[model samples]
Target: MKQLFYFGLAQAKACIFPIIIFLTLAVTKIIDIPFLHRYDLILLVCIITQMLMLALKLETMDELKVIGVFHLIGLALEIYKVHMGSWSYPEEAFTKFLGVPLYSGFMYASVASYMCQAWRRLDLKLVKWPPTWIVMFLSAAIYFNFYTHHFILDFRWLLKLLTIILFYHTFVYFTVRKRTYAKPLSLSFILIGFFIWVAENIATFLGAWSYPNQQRQWEIVHFGKVSSWLLLVIVSFLIVAMLKHLKQTKGNLH
Candidate 1:
């Protein structure tokens, strides 16, 4: 019980970025700014918060780079998904390009930030991590399927199956203070994805974005979206893992 209490505290500390974002979302939804549009306000808040986090040394430079990549990757997908009518940013904002508010990317960045922060705080390690080639190949397939599935057949289920097969044997070792713990890598993906899905529900409820059904009336987001988040979480984890490996490799060469 003591270890579990400490574990929760560590997780909360790692979630600082995401917590701030969520609070901003909720607060901005209810409060009105005189001139600034809500979407623009969100964009501004995300930028300033990121800068503050870096200046304070709360987030390392290397992790900032990873967060930046997630931002771009997320924006691209948001642009494409908006074009395809997957969902929308209905609020008006000068920061919007192609109907996606720039802040949307930050929401994705929060996920990467969480993973990176948790990695640092928990002293995470991988056991029996797959070879670089396989990991890279699988990550590419997961991301590609996210795009191609819109046009071609939806291969999400198959990709999910692949994720299970690829990561089932792998384990994540993490320290909650002095007590170390291990769990299947796949299970971590599912857990993070599940929490992201929960966060998504809250975001939508607070008018962050709206689905087709939500546009007409507030409704529960489809449970199927959990699978989508699961796959996305996998892509995020793989990218972080690869970047960490590269950094370590460089450090060793020094």
Candidate 2:
């Protein structure tokens, strides 16, 4: 029970950036900022928050690099997804481009932030991690499938199954206070994906962005999106894991 409390506390700490972003989304939905567009203001808030965290030593430079990579990757994906008519930034903003608000990328960056923070706060390490080639192949497939599925047949479920098989023996070891606990890496992906799905619903409800169906009226996001989030979480985890592996092993990206 005590360990569980500590684990939850660490999780909350890790989620600081995501929580702040959600709050900003909710507040900006109602609050009028006459001086600036809402999306621009959101972009500004995200920038300021990141700078403050850096100055306060709340986030390490390495983590910032990770967040930066995720930001660009996310923004690129967003640009394409919007172009493909997946979803949209319905409101106006000077910072908007290719139909995506600049701040929208931070939504993905926030997930990377949580992963980075949790890795440190929980003293996380991987066990029985897959080989570098297999991991990289899977990561590439999972990421590309996000875009390919829009044009071709959706291979997400098959990819998910492959992910499970590859990482079935893998585990993440994390410390909760003085005690240590281990969880299957695959299960961790599903749980984080679930929570991100919850956050997505909150973001949509707060008017961060609207799905096609929600554009007319607010509605619960489809459960199918959970699969997308699952793959996304896996991608995010793999990126961070590879970085950690490189740093820790000084070469192997396993």
Q: Judging by TM-score against the true structure, name the best candidate.
A: 1
- Please identify model 2 stretches exceeding 4 Å from their true place: 251-254
The models' CA-based lDDT, in order, is: 0.92, 0.92
Clashing pairs for predicted structure model 1, backbone only: none
lDDT of 2 by residue, 1-254 (tens): 87888889999999989998988988898899898998898899899999998999989999999999999999999999999888988999999998999999999999999999999999999999899788989999999998998779989999999999999999999998778889899999999999999999999999888889998999999998998999999999999999898799965545
lDDT by residue (tens digit), candidate 1, 73-190: 9999999998988998888898999899999999999999999989999999998888888889988898888799877998889988988888889999999877899999999998
Off-target runs (Cα >4 Å) in candidate 1 are: none
Pairs that collide in candidate 2 are none
RMSD of each: 0.9, 1.8
- Name the lDDT of candidate 2: 0.92
Q: Alpha-carbon error at 86 in model 1, in Å?
A: 0.7
Per-residue lDDT of 16 in model 2: 87
